[model samples]
Target: MSATQTAPAAASPSPASAPVKNSRGRVILASLIGTTVEFYDFYAYATAAVLVFPVLFFPTGDPLTAQLASFGVFGAAMIARPLGAVVFGHFGDKHGRKATLVASLLTMGIATFIIGLLPTYAQIGWFAALALLILRLAQGFALGGEWSGAALVATENAPAGKRAWYGTFPQLGAPIGFIIANGLFLVINFSSPSREWFLEWGWRVPFLFSAVMVIIGLWVRLKLVESSAFEKASTKGAIRKVPIGTVFRHHWKELILGTFFMLATYVLFYLMTSYTLAWGIKPADVETAQAAADAAGTPFDAAAFFPGGGFAYPEFVTMQIIGVVFFGVFTMLSGPIADAIGRRRLLIWVTLAIIVFGLTFNVFLMSGGSPRFAGALAQAFLIFGFTLMGATFGPMGALLPELFPTNVRYTGSAVSYNVSSILGAAVAPLIALALWAWVGEPWLVGVYLSVMGVLTLIALIIGKETKDVDYEEAGFSSSAVL
Candidate 1:
């Protein structure tokens, strides 16, 4: 008999057999809150790199070079993420998700708090940057293990028929975290006086405040049980001795496919959040600057594009918070939609939408905005980018878990997800920046995302459909009789 033939039929646990409601809900809650804290810490660094780090930690003779250095440190965390995934995934698969989740959250919180305390280059010279780098690496390492545990928590406890919807609950963390990250900064920015005061201390408030959320996340996570999937898998002694090696041996193609399939999603994220902010702040843009400077407590030439003829970055940062709200609403709706349509299909359509809309949005961006058109167009494109992100990212909660057997689901999905992050998200903002510098135009960067979208579209179209398969029955061919 073939593997499918020998495998038991996919089954859902009944009320008597299913994970009890309180237990499952607690697990989902833990996953959601834990992910929110993790991503909150992660995005806070990303935001600082853009808004404050270039001036604070990496003071330099040239403003441009300082900006590059700030981004360099931001990219460092991405490079560390996959390595963290491998190390943490191994222990997670071998031991349990509960322990791994708690460890990662603690590590992230500590790293972020330390970042808030680091001295600036003015205060401590190069040592400040060194300290920041070390903390960023710690944050990356913790994040590597975070997603896998989140995925497992939601998937393991979900009702079989509603797994896709439940899985999306963990995925909601990205937007929620973004909202909290940007909202905190928005509050600080509004309250501060000059850029001097903001950089002097306001910048650290968000990082220090994370300790409160971390404590809350930890308490919630502690109440959850170890995943039922992990419990069952452990009984069979099926945990891999080394997750990375096992993934390459047994599921190399799927890993590669997932990496490509997720490429466009990450690319769009950088484009909408980081790249748009860059374009808005560059000296060439007059109006965006004027708006920003006014929002700041600074005076400028009213005749200048900005008050002074330079772009103000903080105003755009406020816009990003608004964008996060739109993303949150769209993401919430995408979960049930994915459950109805299937993961693979949703990914394909979204990838196509990104390609088509990405090109059009660039055209709209290049056409200098009129006062009446700017807000509507910008919000529309922001929602467009995030809605595409939502459609693909929402189903991922179910899709990644469904790709692996319960025996090693935690390890396998974590590795693949983080590996995808490295290839797709880790370098995305850097690459887009590099592309723009290389070609001297944003259109070239759009082409880069378009190409990635096409690649991911192909991957989704060619990949096997996974809607109905049970976790244990995943990755087997339908041709194999059960």
Candidate 2:
């Protein structure tokens, strides 16, 4: 008998049996919590890179170079993601989603905790920077494995006819994590006495708090059962022999489509989060070093005077944190909206909005006014941009898994998602930094979003719509031979 024929009937459950209260809800909760913790760890680094790292790790005399170096470290995680996807996805397909989900969370938590404890550049010289880099790469590896398992958990447990709607649950982690990550920093920024006080201790609080989030994520994930589809695949020995190779050999087209389709989403994310924070600092009234100089009576050059060592101003940190909360609110609304409207249609519209908004973000920053007004504009832009991101990002939970078959779905979806991370999301801040420095005009960064948006549009136009497709029957078949 074929491997497909060897499993219990639950392996092929109909839509009615897969209701939200059944196995479906348990799987969605597990996947959502796991991804939330992973993103919390990952995005916390992005927040730190913008607000603290240039002062802490790379203390070059030139502010621009130091900031770029900080962003370079931020980009390192994306570069490591694809490699992680292959390694973890291979095992996830062969072993199961539960194992990979658990391992990825533990790895991310350990790396993030180490980041909280690392000695400053002053204490260990170059070693502090080295430690941060190693930890960032580990975070990347963990994230790489994270999405595949989370997505599979949702897709596999979803009701047959409404998988797209349920699968989107894991995707909610992006915005929810964004909310918690930024909200914690906002609290820290507001609580500090002087900007100097904030830079010295405020930034570390968010990274340190990650231990609690990971614990919660682990507890929830531990309760999850193995995905019904994967359980069946394992019983029959139909899991891809060499998953990545199998994907590359047989389904390269879908992989490529998935990569481009995801590019606009990723780029817009980094632009809104990391790039927006960078722009806010360079142009706003807050002296990144004002707090240290006020107390020390020395002219504080931020690149020369790292935080944890000291800071220049404090009020501005609160403003930035407020802006992040706006981002979180929009993310919360995206999942259900995508379920209501198809993923493809929503993504196309949102891609266009990002292209337009990316350009407008710089315009608002460059236009002069009281710092308060600029802060308001910044908040509005971030909220609006993240709103569109939520809309399209909502659907990807279902869309990716629906693109591939059960046998190699884990591997294929992972490659597609991580490859998009490397190409679009991971490199975005670095690209934005380079463009801003190279031309002295941040608007050019919008051009980057526009190009990717156009590509996403084209890809979606040519792609299949999986809104109603049966999960078991999605994507192409893998031949028994590799």
Candidate 3:
């Protein structure tokens, strides 16, 4: 019998059997917690890449170059993510979701913890930077499998018409993780007496604290049953022996569409988080500010040095926290709205909105008439960008999985998601920095953002609306050759 035509195995739960509300709730919780831990670990590194890694890991020269180098290391994880997706996607599709998730979690947790203990350039020279790069790769690798698995866990267990709502649970992790990571950094930043001391040791605390979050994630994920969809596929002997190859062979169209469909979302997020942090913390005319502070026998505080040029680090982080709150709120709202209208329809509208926002993004930054004005402008940029991000990103968990058949769902979704990261996220900060330095205009970056939004808009127009599709059906033909 053909794979799709095979009878359901006795070991598998019936696809038609209604999912219990309580069990579905558990799946959501498990998925949310797993993603939260993964992203917290991930974003912690990102924040440090800007605020600490440059000084700690590198032999400092120019601050901007060092910062760019740190961002390059940050991109290393994005570079490794697709490889992780291929490896873990195979296991997830062929073995099971829960097993793969647990393994990914362990890998990420261990790498993050090790990064905290790693020696800096002052202690170990180049070896310190090398170790940081290796650990960053490990973080990328683990996260490759994380998002797709968590998304599947939630969406697969969703009741009829609630997939979008369930999908948002995993999406919620992004804002929560951002808040937690930044909040901890803020606490440490304030409590410490000296910037030198904080840079020396206080930053490591967040990375080390990841151990606790990982333990919690593991405990929750361990309790999760494999999704009924995967179990059903397994029982019917429908699991692809090499899921990555199978997806590439059969689902190439969905893969391409899914990747581009996410371009704007990925670009907007990294731009707002990492790139914005870099821009905001930069001292306005570094030499002038440093000279004034030195003449006064005080250290140059970038936050106060250039009232019209750059933000105080602490003030900018606080604004970002506020923006993240808006991100979280809109993320929750997007789900129910998506459920009401349609994922594709909402995405098209949101992408269009992002294009408009991207074009105007630099106006606020340019209007730094006063410190207060600059801060408000920065907050507006973040709140508006994140609000649009929520609408764009919120539907992705449901949208990606729904695009492919269950047999290759994990591989397909993971590859698409990670590939988009490489395309949009991995190089965004680097590109933004280069644009700002070379062209000397922030609006150019806005134009770049708008271009990505246009790309996504085109992809959405070309792709099918999948919200109404029956996810339980093995949508592919049994006669299809692998």
Against the true structure, whose TM-score is highest?
A: 3
Candidate 1, residue 57: the lDDT equals 68
lDDT of 1 by residue, 329-349 (tens): 766677677778877877777
Query: Model 2, 1-482: lDDT tens per residue?
Result: 77667676637787776633326557767878877887777678887886667767777656677777888888888888888888888888777777788888889898998898887676676788989999999999888889878888887877655566676678778767877887787777767786677667778888889889889888878777776676667666677778888789888888988888888988887887777666655423246465553444333365432321011223444454455555445544554555567667767777777767766746655556776676666556656776777666767877787677777787888889989988887678888888876876667888888888888888888886666555554224732211
**Worst lDDT 10-window in candidate 3:** 473-482
Better of 2 and 3 by lDDT: 3
| lDDT over C-alpha atoms for residue 318 of model 1 | 62
lDDT by residue (344-405, candidate 3, tens digit) is: 88999999999999898678678447778777777888899989988888899899888778
Native RMSD of candidate 1 (Å): 7.8
Ranking by lDDT: 3, 2, 1
Candidate with better TM-score, 1 vs 2 = 1
Candidates in order have lDDT scores of: 0.72, 0.73, 0.83
lDDT of candidate 3 vs native?
Answer: 0.83
In model 3, which residue pairs have backbone atoms overlapping below 3 Å?
303-312
Candidate 2 has its poorest 10 consecutive residues by lDDT at: 304-313
